[model samples]
Target: MDTSLDDLDHDYAASIADRAMRAMAEQRIPPTPTNFAVWFQYFAGSHDDLRNAIDLLIDHNRPFDARINQDLFETYVAPQVSAVVVDTSERLHELMGTAKDFLATAIADNHSQIQAISDVAGQGQAGVDPKALVAQLMNELARAASRATRLEAGFAEKTRELDVIRDSLSKSEQRARTDTLTGLANRRALDEFLRKAQTTAEWGEPLSVLLLDIDHFKTFNDNFGHGVGDQVLRLMAKVLREKVREQDLSARYGGEELIAVLPDTDLAACTEIAERIRRAIAEAKITRRSTGEVLPGITVSIGVARYRVGETVTDLIERCDRALYLAKGGGRNRVVTENELDRAEAAG
Candidate 1:
């Protein structure tokens, strides 16, 4: 025996082989020489190697353990382990060839027998021997057929489980990227959008960003309470989404502040979109659905900045934020551009 084989725990192999044989017997499969050969092969080989060999043998209609055990030992094991290695090698080769021929013949015979039985069964004759009928059924359908069915069912179940897992993960991802209060994209989502927008801008596709803040928001919260203030915020988000193009992204940037990312858009287009959003908010009649109490109207001060070549997403956002500050300083309901910032800086 090879040193590796010797090192292997034979007891474990023997136990497994024994259990396998017992299972076969319980299934009423006759313990033939071929079956013993297969069992011996499984016991002597590594688990993975044994499994592969068994699968091949089963496909070839030579799955009986005795047949595998006898063939494997004669063809591979005996030669490697025997004291008279030369003689063992010659004998192993001869026996292996003989086993191959024997298996081919057995398979042909079994096929012929099955065909004959199937023809007889198809005739629908009465008074056929029940045991013979059962044997025919087992040979034709029961053996290995049930295993295939089980494997298919197991695969389908696993597929369903994977789909469910994927759906749960998708929902979790959405929650992580969204603001809970306004049901809009949050800062995390905005950062991702900005990074993508920056890449597009580098590719010669202009990108624009808008930063807008609700005017006098603190006073609304103070006078009408936080609940009404929240209602106003939600309504504003709805209007922003409704007004912005499908390609644009709207996000809530902390309290009373929002941001929009517009891909392939210039400063003028972004300003127009911002104005539309502003007009929508000014015209919207947002009252407490629960209380029917009219809430104070709101307006947004917006800053529009086109992404400059070689500028980072952070730089564009900061410039837009500064422009928004300027808009607030100027009036509170107007749109300010980065050009205005340049003019202001030059004047200063």
Candidate 2:
């Protein structure tokens, strides 16, 4: 945090983490900040004596501060840098198309359930066992509903797999950046992209970041298992993919936190997109597969903020973060932007 903060403000954790790993590699020492510092300096070639000592230590025995060194490794190790990768519109459409046919079959077989309609258009009579027929109608509807629900989960899983493959194939440089969990761009990637995007924004193009977090995630995870929690994450990811555009960059910023960087976009444009995503997720129903019980559905809180000239990525992120908290504070399942926050502040 000392002098490093000055140069590493862009990505504090990532920079130190990367250096710490390399330092550990060169020194062949256990990962510790003390060992990291000695080797961090050694790799930079700033101190000849320390570098020589580390070099000698690479072949010779050495001692390091165990606690501090361990802390450094735990703190910095680059945090599992993840990459974003996915394609969903195609598969989703296919499943939905197939589901539509299933739904039609269910409805046709159960036409008598409709109070206003006849089993045969003009035939005004439903000639079947009211009990067994009712059971049969329920079975067909349940089957169709189950098919759609299963597809929803499969869609999420396939989307994540596709994302991982896409990044692996075309974005070879980003291979190390892929997150193991969600397959979305990791926090490190988000920071890297912000650094470059900031450079272009300084020239006057609009830039914005939408900070998003899942609502009641903990309650859901606790009520269901972590497996269902993962399902919710994938569900949100698919929604993000559906709503995302060609120029947009979406990333998983740790836990249930996410981000969508929209270059050449303003607050209004960004808010509109956020609302669309909010509504889309709100309307979708996710059912428990183990039991037919309907679990509480998913919702997200979003904070939209546009970049300002001369601001660091940290500042931009912080403002957006504050707005995101505002969205969370006001109520869950809503979008709050810096524009609205500014207005509220001015009035107060």
Candidate 3:
């Protein structure tokens, strides 16, 4: 059964990669990383608008680059998050109203019960017939008990509705911040985390970010197919989960790109962590699933950077990315730090 499930996943991924290739060929587009990422989304039916946008761009002979790719993400994925937030907010309002209504009903019911008790007490002491007073008290008690039971039922039903709404909102929020393929935090999540981390880092602890690029990823994708390419990405995510602290976060930044956010960390510690990840990737074996054939394992280039006080999220990300570029330039499968890059240039 496991093997069958694996085959299903393998075939599914292969189909996606195959469709991506077709899209590139059909549009006469270059098989660049940006184009590949875009077409992959197109093939996956992520959004009708994404497909239409790509078609329009191709028709206009526009270049596919980071700007266009980012635009696509902003259009399709980011908006859903906002919509979900608004929808969730509205649901919360309804929940609040329900609670307020319940409170009002409870207060009114209690007041009625109090008034009934006062009337019975007055009648009993003011020379009213005993039989009449007893009957009146019994009626008031039954009314109170009936009201309480009804209110309890209403509370149960209304609270259940609120629970359902809360759950829906939670799932929507998760979807907004999660990468579909790797099940890691998405780029949006990373951006948000960086922003908050920056604030906390100013007064509390240091923050660090790492940018990782799979070495020769395009060639690997072309040779071993997208199934293996996805396998490689998932493996990277797994290592990140295994090695990083619970407080740290790992996310898929984009195609063949991953980000790690570390709180209470410095450059020295982050660099050491990056090196560990690099070495782990180098040492792990990757095998072809279908034939059980041992294939060549892949490595990654990583860049480490520390968040500076008052630095924007973009600034931190760019610094880390620059270090990653330097690592790739220094030769793939190595880790580089922002300080190291600065020192190298100064020495040169």
Candidate 4:
């Protein structure tokens, strides 16, 4: 019998792992190795910087999105990016030096060949054969041309490789700001949009937020499994994408909740947009892939709240969330606005 296995605190380890996973899932974060390690350390209280950053995000009610996860990985878990950058810079410098030397040699060779042709041309046929001189000039020109071609090809290839690297890095960053499940802007992107929108609102531009939650999503998952639930979610996301204007942003606000940030839109206009989205989602249908059977129509409870000047992002979100709660309490599949909630509270 191995005593080491028994000596380990299996329960504690399991507890920590479970907590980490649930936290990730709650935030709609993929359980990639990088994300999992960051979260595990967060729950285990092993890394001070990582824990504090995550705590601040949570305290602010900020969503732990893919971008935030990558930031944490870079800032705390793997801080070797600066070292990698320095190494890359050194390699680039070395490559430049090699290229410079190669070009210098090529230029010197070409110059010498031109000088020989010039000398031959300058000789007034005293001892030079005309055909021989012509042949020598042609050879010099051919060699110079060949060298130039090779140099051009080498540089062209390197430029293509750099372009490919640039594109890959760009795509990776975009993916970090995108939700894997719904193909919408993740919470990090949403938060950034809200900040800009808040600034615009302070300048007298109207902004609004629409928070939507799928009705009875947990029950739907339990009855039809996550696969069908995912289909329902995708359907809802598609509806949102189609219903909103180009300037508006639709994003996954974590499990079963989606949001739209409407810029330059007032409360009345925002409510209209929210109602349209609600209707579209209710009309959308999803089919179960396994059985090839159509599942039930999806419905969402929507909450609309217009931005107030000088309000924090968290405060605006909380007000919108309260409207959503009212919608849920009133009855599922309805749209509620902050003004309506305010009226109700005042009456009470």
Alpha-carbon lDDT, every model: 0.72, 0.69, 0.82, 0.81
**Tens digit per residue, CA lDDT, model 2, 217-294:** 868876886567777787887788679797688887756788889899988999999999999989989877778678
For candidate 1, which ten residues in a row score worst on lDDT? 27-36
| Model 3 stretches with alpha carbons more than 4 Å out | 1-52, 62-70, 81-90
Give the candidates in order of TM-score, highest first: 3, 4, 1, 2
Provide the global lDDT of candidate 1 against the true structure.
Answer: 0.72
What's the best-to-worst order under lDDT? 3, 4, 1, 2
lDDT (Cα) of model 2: 0.69
Over all chains combined, what TM-score does candidate 1 have?
0.61
Q: 1-348 in candidate 1: lDDT tens per residue? A: 233324658886566568657755643333433344445455545444545765686678764432344345445443433444454446556655655665565567568657866675864477678787777766666544554565556556655655665576567668666766678897778888888888878989989988888999878876876567777888888988887888789998766788889999888888888889888888878778788977667888999999999978889889999999999999888889999988987899
lDDT (tens digit, per residue) of candidate 4 on 184-230 = 89777898988888988998899999999999987887798666777
Q: Candidate 2's error at 32, in angstroms?
A: 25
Q: The CA-based lDDT of model 4 is what? A: 0.81
**Winner by TM-score between candidate 4 and candidate 3:** 3
Model 1: how far is 308 from its true place, Å? 0.7
What 10-residue stretch in candidate 2 is worst by lDDT? 77-86
